[model samples]
Target: MAWTVPGLLAVVLVAALLTAMARGYALRRQLLDQPGERRSHAVATPRGGGIAIVVSQLLAYIGVGVLFPQAAATLAIFSAGLVMVAGIGWWDDHRPLPALPRLGVHVLAGLLLGALVWHWTGEASSAGFSVLLAIALINVWNFMDGIDGLAATQALLASVAYALLLPAPVAGLALILAAGVLGFLPFNFPKARIFMGDVGSGALGYLLAGLVALGLGTRSAPWTILLVPLAAFLVDAGLTLAGRVFRGERWMEAHTQHLYQRWVKSGCSHVMVTSGYALFGVAGIVLMHVFTWLPSPWSHLAALAWAAAAAGLWSVLLNKVHR
Candidate 1:
């Protein structure tokens, strides 16, 4: 525990260094994402800077495996799944891949993570939830990552929230995740040096699912509390997807239809939208701590209430900005 701050700093440094290197690699390889009508950014930028975060987190997993040999097998399984998700994403970033094959790899990775959840808690329900969480988060993150700072910043805040709720080992892992994102944030936020790419965003979702699975397995807190930190993104991404589907649109097609994207298009700066979402995240953290102290049914009720409030706010904002 005493070494946590130092360890976090070390990982942050490693992630920053790795991100810088990833940027160079992308530029050298001419892996550029051009600005487009369906896109958010205004200029061409090197993608896949997320490889740095993936590499940094994988190294952290290795260190954990070495320190706790008993946990190595499970960590190995988790790492394998992580590789699948990141691997597909990395490949896609270099050469565009069809959605079905990419979804297939994501499903496989989700199953692997689901098995880890089952192994941890022996609960089929929890395992099922992990699978869905993995798949949902992977794509949700990818969809929401349209703007500078939104995806990574949300992840950093959520990881910090989970770290506070989980036990020591997993908590430390969460902190390390937050630190790695922190390291990447400087290069991303306020201005874009390099995008997180599919590699980073998908892997990030899987990594968060891993944390949620561990938290559920350990009974660190109520499952509802675990959902709090993710409320904002789920609301935006879920509603946007549903809207597209209801309108008989190609739901999976890349588009700037998300609430955050609309906000950006409505003349609000990326900083404003990101900061607004962050306020909700900070509120979620505060609510998580409050939910911890409440009785069981009440805590669950409060989480639902907060989520409803979030959805309501999202609707109001969406209508306002759509005008």
Candidate 2:
């Protein structure tokens, strides 16, 4: 990687520039998300800005493929899956699509990712897990994208953490994503000028899942440690979704039932809630790195402990916060 520094810089610049362009297009086209009961923001805002991140990431992949021709097949597969996820999301952002159809596309993309990982690692279990993880994250990030800075910051932290934990190629991919998210964060945080929309959120989740799969494939670190960075978002999104489904509600529909949403409804600012999640993300990243130094059973056990603690916190938050 002689192109490492240049790739990162290019991604950041492209992401920022594309986000601005997307925002302008959204505004001109009147593609805005207006405040309502289901939404967290108070004002109508331009969306579809996440297309910037998607485009930037695709470019990064192409760049990598061009530089390292040996990785071209893997990158092509990865890029196809990404386009599938991002394409459906991009459509939904423009003209809302039904949940099942979007989900079908996600499943298809998941299978593609599963195959890619299977090819990389020659492991059936990793392939299976990759499928599940891709589907799970594609929706989780969308679910957690309700508040300002929350989704983007979590992505930034998770990608950077993966970059540190994984080996080359995959590690480089993760860093490029982190740089892209870093460029997109300012427009969305403190005061959101534009939203990532479905396009950005779902694509991000897909990319994160892709990175996790690559890490597993490369055997860069223990599988358990690779998952530690995503604990907070997963716990929040998973438990909230589980609770919804258990109650026989239309779980696919958007609502403000997440703990982060409840905290905001309970009078916390977006910055406060977002920053709090960032701290959890930072803590998880540190813990994962720490676990890398520990032995097998201990590292795995420690990761499980972190997840358990997150689940406990989820329970506690639900008890303390009133809708």
Candidate 3:
């Protein structure tokens, strides 16, 4: 497949238009948006914008994969993983489902999609590592969803950035995903008109895990592509959970201890906070590849240690932010 700027642009445009239209419809319908304390923004914004993102990305992947059968199997697994996100996220959006039930869906979805992905691409060995990676990313995306447009914005930046970095199948699909979220950002940014809700955030999270896995395991571009840019989310989620455990608090329940959440609570602008995270994430990726020539082991222990330390430090650091 020839890499062309026009082709990528075309995919992005399609995604943006699709997401914008879906968000517009949600606005017109006055869907479920009950904003109050605990939310990033004060205004009531339309929700469920993730539905459009899921649809646009799925369609784009299918269209591309059909044209390039060699990539079809890999993409089919991606598309299936997305369906899991949509099915379960949409259900949660309509009515908050039990935590265990919702988690069961995520777990099953991750495992099933993981199996398909592993089988289709001979990623079986990678799957052993990817199962935990996939689940961690899904939670990272979910936990980072607290701020207005933060999760969606991160998805958009990471997708496009990584696409530019690795332009084959990963970049192609990422182009579409980025476009879809970019189209929705205007409505979801600092002063949001609509939110991505669980639909967009969850699906984006799942898709990201797939992209990173493909990029790292197959492309071997750099480990940083999968880690640093996402450090903000990973650190926050990992650290928050660690802190909770240390403090004898439940890890899964809703809370405002996330670094991003703490920043917002301290009277910082949401855009400023979100942008800070994005920059830090991009920095992490850059640093990863600065020495890309070095052969390295894919150390899960090291990754966890980094995440745990970062989270722990951030949890403590946040205490001094507004206090």
* Whole-model lDDT values for every prediction: 0.92, 0.92, 0.70
Provide the lowest-lDDT 10-residue window in model 2. 314-323
Pairs that clash in candidate 1:
none
TM-score between candidate 1 and the true structure: 0.98
Better of 1 and 2 by TM-score: 1
lDDT of 2 by residue, 198-220 (tens): 99999999999988997898887
Residue 90 lDDT (model 3): 79
Q: For model 2, what is the error of residue 291's alpha carbon versus the real structure, in angstroms, after optimal superposition?
A: 1.2
Per-residue lDDT of model 3, residues 197-258, tens digit only: 77777788888877777665555564543565566677777767888999998787777877
lDDT of 1 at 293: 94
56-166, model 1: which lDDT tens digit per residue? Answer: 888887887888899889989999999999999999999999999999999999999999888888899999999999999999999999998999999999999999999
The order of the candidates by TM-score, greatest first, is: 1, 2, 3
Scanning candidate 3 in windows of ten residues, the lowest lDDT window is 291-300
Candidate 1: list runs displaced more than 4 Å: none
Higher-lDDT candidate among 1 and 3? 1
